[model samples]
Target: MASGFSLKDQLFNREKTRYLAGLFAASHAGFDPDRFEAEVMAELPALELKQRISLIAEVLSRHLPQDPEGMAAAILNALPPPLDPSLSDDDFGDFIFAPLGELVELRALETAPDLSLDVLAEITKRFSMEWAIRPYLVHWTDKTLARMEVWAEDENYHLRRLVSEGTRPRLPWGQAVPLALSQPLPLLDRLSGDPTRYVTRSVANHLNDISKKDPELVLTRLRQWQAEGVQSQSELDWITTHALRGLVKQGHSGAMEMLGYDPAAPVTAHLQLGPGPVRIGGALEFDCMLQGPSDAPVLVDYRLHFQRPGGKLSAKVFKLKQTRLKGGTARLSKRHPLKAGASTFTLVPGLHRLDLLVNGIERGSLTFDLLAQAE
Candidate 1:
């Protein structure tokens, strides 16, 4: 080992040394590593980016296992703002900064009550809905409820974006916040008539999620919203489709009743089983029909409730559009393939119940057995 290495010499000696120095400078503040590294990695910017990411990952991995909270804070503090602000717009910055920000907020949640709300608000102010809202929604609490309620009224388009995007139940690539599920009517009431198309789309998705769990409530709200006449055409369209998603797909009798349609109209369903079931692989198919009165046009929605390996039933709905019911006959049909995992693995091996919900209420049911077969 060298007897007396200068700070300058130490930094130039190795990649690890450079990384450690950067980490320390960021943690301590006022020591400009960017100014210093301008010369150290001047010739190889790509290498610099890679080394920085690796260094951050290594530090996080080493410390998170022992002190996730402290480690998270350190990581956020250690992130260097991009050397060129333009470079910040790229995915590399997102990869480096997004996780650091999310982890910092999550850890803050663990250490400080309601910290996520403030952190999330700051993040929304800085980034778009596509980036910040998901993390905040997944970890939301009543502690942040008042703040979020206020955000629902924000004039900023992005903050308004947060209102709907954060509360969506089935947001793709996003975690579902169950708490928001119970009291959506108020939030929906606030955003249902928003002028922003971006915000309205999220409202529709949120309503769609609600429809699956409680179609009656969704339909009630839809009726109330329609009666109040406070909604725009876009809002009405969103609410109508989402509130009826579950019922329409399942062809629930009650759902039809709510939609001002008669369920007593003749209807038929057919089930077609695929190749024999395997222990870990197999699929199922369904077909159905709806016969309308001589002069009335009928819309039939259908869905399949699957019973998994553990005695739990999961329902998935599909839309069947509109068809003219010739007084004599109107045909409605559907096909579905079931896969293994959370949705299909909850039903136990014994006899299981498969129900067909027309609008929002069950109209028909069938029993089927799941046997553990050889692979």
Candidate 2:
């Protein structure tokens, strides 16, 4: 087993990596375990996360049953069983459970030619096949929508969540379904009032995705949801806060106002990045001071413009803290991590800029250099 966080590395864990070939060989006829094992592991260390997932799908295509429906059913048969309804309480939450879901994703796509919602319906019950459903959305738009309409009413929370998550216009790392991007509301309308937290969270995320492209639609819908008073205020607030996350970060006045911030107010912001040229693994200590004229609410967050691989800079927001300030003064400090461990980000030796943003307005900036780790 390899120890790492990247999808490529995560896939090759304690048991699944070594035995995926064996599982295929044992389940299907004509797949030589030795050959498949050698092929998969040989290509593994060279590929990144998404590529590795594609490799798994391709390997399955080469070895699985020739008939599409048969291949889909065989993949489902290969899955251990219906997951315990309570994922958090059972081993179902463990990483060991992921490989089955990964297989279901491939099975969803591999069996797409047949367009059997029944197979996907069954497969998703055990493992999510959201990525697999994208192809059908592209090739058989109407049919895919018909099936999704049915999945929306599904008893399983996972399937209902998938009804929103799978159709996200810009699902992060998942396939982009353009139709949903153009007309996000209709699908959202179906899942909007869902009672389950899991389903509602996905619905919030889907609206967040749309907020990136079409902010008004999301704002209008959120406002409508609040006006209609269908769901409790707390649930609606969660959706509003999450869905408008990007907008809030960008300091969109409308979004800020909706979230109960007065962007028009004034505040003095003091930011400091100290002890320049820190080692890669050390922490970057920061201090901030906020002084407001009147009793006004403000949302505070920070952005770090990182040095990218190509020498270009990309900014990422890190949540610092949220608080309500009295008329006078407030002080906040954070010791942010410089070193990377299992996170997606890799620590690179370069110069970076940090910004203090209050109510989405950049107030202060500092330049700092990160040195390579000490030997």
Candidate 3:
């Protein structure tokens, strides 16, 4: 990423706030675009990304009619044309319209849930309503799910994606819904065959979240989907790989087998680390050779056991290579970076370890010293 990049600014800024205000102003004669823009801008820069979204929604509540029907009408009318329908994938729509979903949640969740769902269905075409739909799922579980069953078959791909994305067990930055992991499986069953990558990716991610809690549940579902063959063989393969990513990192034998890797295959690994201590802001270079049965596929991954300040080691997994052995042998190498300045995780100078995993089995490991960067 470029230095000084601000995601919040890029997603929600003065221009975006003003654009939303203009849309509403055009829809409602009584709506004042300048006032709405001013109120949202006042706190938008000071707040974080999510807070900015709430700030805009709160401002909308004060400006728009308080009644549920009028509010819903204003929001729906204000929305720009639905995102291009010709595109098959990778269109997430605009971020400015997200507040519209939040506004719907605030104005009509309890008093007029059906109307709220109606508005969200339209608003989602301009932007995903994944976050807004969770409260309904938590409070009106059966009712909301019943509605989702209908949405799963909607003509709009975005609405179809909302069904899967909204129900994710571990949706990032999303509100937690208390539904049982299995409860949403039925909905996923319907969405698993969606032709759009946008929808299928969400289905895969939702299953990946479930795999964290119930590996067998996800494995079983994948098996059933494969047997049923609702989706093409290639597309289902993509979904299976994406959904089982977490389990693969954990060296789950069942997940490995499901992906057609033999966890118990006879394999031997030899690891060699580059000379000299690795410093922060430098790279940790290493190479390895694997000896396995000819024509057998191998899923190779390297785990780095990072040393923390208090002598505890935090392990992180990274993909190395995925290929079939040639002449019963394969060679792989990597140059992992050690950045001194990182936003999330800090690097500590100390002894660290790297372990090689092939087909969900640890084959070899070695230790190396990490040094502080030069001042």
Candidate 4:
């Protein structure tokens, strides 16, 4: 991202707002595009991204008919068209259409719950309703999930994705639903064999969220899926790897074994660190060599223990390489940059430690000093 990049401004600007207003204007002649655009633009610049979405939806609700049926009809009519059907993945549709989902959540959830689901089904075809659907899942859990069961088989991939994404335990910027962790498993089982990567990715992510709380449950479900032979081997492999990423980072033996890596493999290793102390803005280079049984697979990782305030240290894992030993030997090197100007974590100048992990086991460790950048 370039400097001074404002995501809220980029997504909900005057042009996009006008475009939405025009769509509604074309559908409802009585709809005032000017007022809709003006109200949205007024508070938009001051609000955050999600707040801007609420502002647009609020403004739109005032312009539409107060009656539920008429409001839903106008929104359905104003839609430009469902997003292009040909693309398999990465077509998230326009963010401008997201507010319409909020409109559905607001107007129809109470007076017309089933009708709200219907509108959401259509609006999701234009833009995903994952965020909007959470409230329904909470207040009308069984009914919404029953409807999602049918959607799991829908022809539209976006709707199919919502069956998983909407119910995810850890959806980004989404409200939580009061349901058991395994409640959505049946839906995931149905979607596990989805042909589209867009749907499968959501299934994988949903499983990943489940894994955080119950690793064994996720692993068991994966085993069941594997036995069913529903999804292709290659795709299943991708899903398994992605879903267990958190466990693998934590050196969970079950996760490593499932991915065909022997966490306890007998391997000898040595690490060589470039001369320190490394500056805050400089790179920390290192070389590592491993010796093991012939052709044994290795999942190599490194951990950097950083010095934090209050004389404590925090460790972060990083991937190094994934390869098999060639002639009983494997060598890897990396030039990891200790970047400055990071907004999340500040680099402190002090003693730091680096540890090498082979097949999830720490093989070698070393310590070095990090210097603050010169003014």
Candidate 5:
């Protein structure tokens, strides 16, 4: 599987290179003997993932039929099938995505919109061309969006997923579409009732993305969906929970109430942090002692207010646990590992505060000293 961070390793490895060579050979045999492989191999180790894709596109530009449409047609020829073999087969990840997706991205924007749409409609079914499709949506918004509405009705789940995923206003790792950001309700209306888990998940995530901008609108729609009962109950539940995850975490009252969390539920909490002055990269153990209304469900989370090197503090919340306290009190102990390896933050030495959030309400807090990291 391709790791999220490094597609270069997963896509451009020796075996993948040979596979690409083989696929090109199988499709267009007269291209080259050693020359094509030489060009690709030379660039493989030298470039990152984005650079590699661009380089491959450039290489294809030199070799494929001269005209852009002809080139697109030739590249489109390389695709195996829309939904012939499931993506679970090993070849789907880099084998299809690295080579084919790049071709769609590099050429589709420049080619005729219809031709590009034709290729994208097929390419997306195999591996998403969501990133490539953005340019079209931005420049040719109406036509592309009309087509997307039709795609929302496609029989294939992949196509349905693309309808929501591609049109997301704030798609992570994807280019932002300003139009989609402003007016996603129409697409959501079309895609929201989709029953497929894969499609519904994308729709939920798309709504979640919109939620960040207009939390109230998304909440209203989610509440409406819950009331309508038009979609699959289980899928809707999943969508509602995930779509409201961000708002729920922030302790929005409407969001909390939608999830049946009663803010007025009486609860008392005490937080304890152990063994002051722990070193960076060491573990910090803490306990949350709580007494709450009997048999009530609780969602427990903690926030770490980390001090920056410049002395400003930035806080991030992490879920601790969720359980039903069937009785008088419960004490939960947790270990937080403080390591500075490949994470967003480097564990800096400063005064750090940890807080307990019960049902999205910050109830208790304590501070601890993190000693300067060892040289």
Candidate 6:
């Protein structure tokens, strides 16, 4: 509801100064107005707590464009200490105190190299979930990785936890970093067999994020781990499902193959012509059959690939939920009408490949000869 002024202006305005001064006075803290304002603004109050931390972040982001390190230090020093543990359940306490704790941790990460590892370890210990540290964790070069690896071996679970916990790709409330997702496998391998559940869950989430963009890579890793008998069924299930989600959605051939479905099985496809292809108006009907294996039920996905006038191919996958394997064979079929533009089309008459992709991993190709009649 509050608008008009930029976040910076809203933060350093007269009203905020008075409110901050009053807060300082109530805490029995001595304040020199000029110095206090300068210091406090650098580490702006989390006054609205998480609800308004974004606003504070905007103000800091704008003001500290050049010296994030110095600004971070000033913010950390300005925070109130942790609130009494007993007051954690109090609503007002959460709004007032929790933000202070979180802000301290956030700034601690911003000033990580200057802060002792022990100090960073302590902050991570207290605010493992709420603290924002992804920026620092992601920027780690090989040199920093070496330093972190040493910390990963520390006896303190918190510091050791930081190695996995801080770099988690799917960590709730943490930013998703694709590069971190790529590099975390080695770190996860180091911690996978550890006696701690805390570390293993982080490993699982890291694998989960990787599965989205590169299902094959995750599958390869899982297969290797399974071969070694090092990965549990639970880990395999998590990785397989997450990694295959996108492929399944798109009905990619590799995904179906990984899932153990055959795509090249001989099948009959029937095409029911609709209004013939016109400039931009036409539709077609497609019906197809998929045979299943003798021993188990088969799940099949359907895809249609259209060739354009320029000889380029575009494919769209569709899931056929009714297909099922029975006895020695599965009778899988579907009837769908494709809209002209919705279905594949070529601006010019030509031969095109229409592929039926199964379970996103297997493919069946069909050729269609199209001729465009002049108006």
lDDT of 3 by residue, 289-310 (tens): 9998998899999999999889
The parts of candidate 5 lying over 4 Å away from their true place are 1-7, 83-92, 108-111, 180-182, 275-277, 341-343, 373-375
Off by over 4 Å in 4: none
Using alpha carbons, what is the TM-score of model 1?
0.53
Higher-TM-score candidate of 1 and 4: 4
Clashes of 5: 0
Q: What is the C-alpha lDDT of each candidate?
A: 0.54, 0.71, 0.93, 0.93, 0.74, 0.50
**Model 1 poorest 10 in a row by lDDT:** 85-94
Q: Which tens-of-lDDT digit does each residue in 208-265 have in candidate 4?
A: 8998999999999999999999999999999999998888888888999999999888
lDDT of 2 by residue, 268-371 (tens): 78887665656678887889889885566778889988887889888899887667677566788988877755357877779988899887777778888877
Estimated TM-score for each candidate: 0.53, 0.77, 0.98, 0.98, 0.89, 0.47
Q: Rank the candidate models, highest lDDT first.
A: 3, 4, 5, 2, 1, 6
> How many clashing pairs per prediction, in order?
24, 0, 0, 0, 0, 10
lDDT agreement of model 3 with the native? 0.93
Q: Which regions of candidate 3 deviate over 4 angstroms?
A: none
Cα lDDT tens digits, model 1, 144-177, are 5566688889775556667666666776655556
Clashing pairs in 6: 251-360, 252-360, 252-361, 253-360, 253-361, 253-362, 254-361, 256-361, 292-330, 301-359
Ranking by TM-score: 3, 4, 5, 2, 1, 6
Show model 2 residue runs off by greater than 4 Å: 1-14, 17-65, 72-79, 86-115, 180-182, 272-281, 293-295, 305-314, 340-354, 365-375
How much does candidate 4 score in TM-score? Answer: 0.98
Candidate 4, residue 25: how far the Cα is off, in Å: 0.3
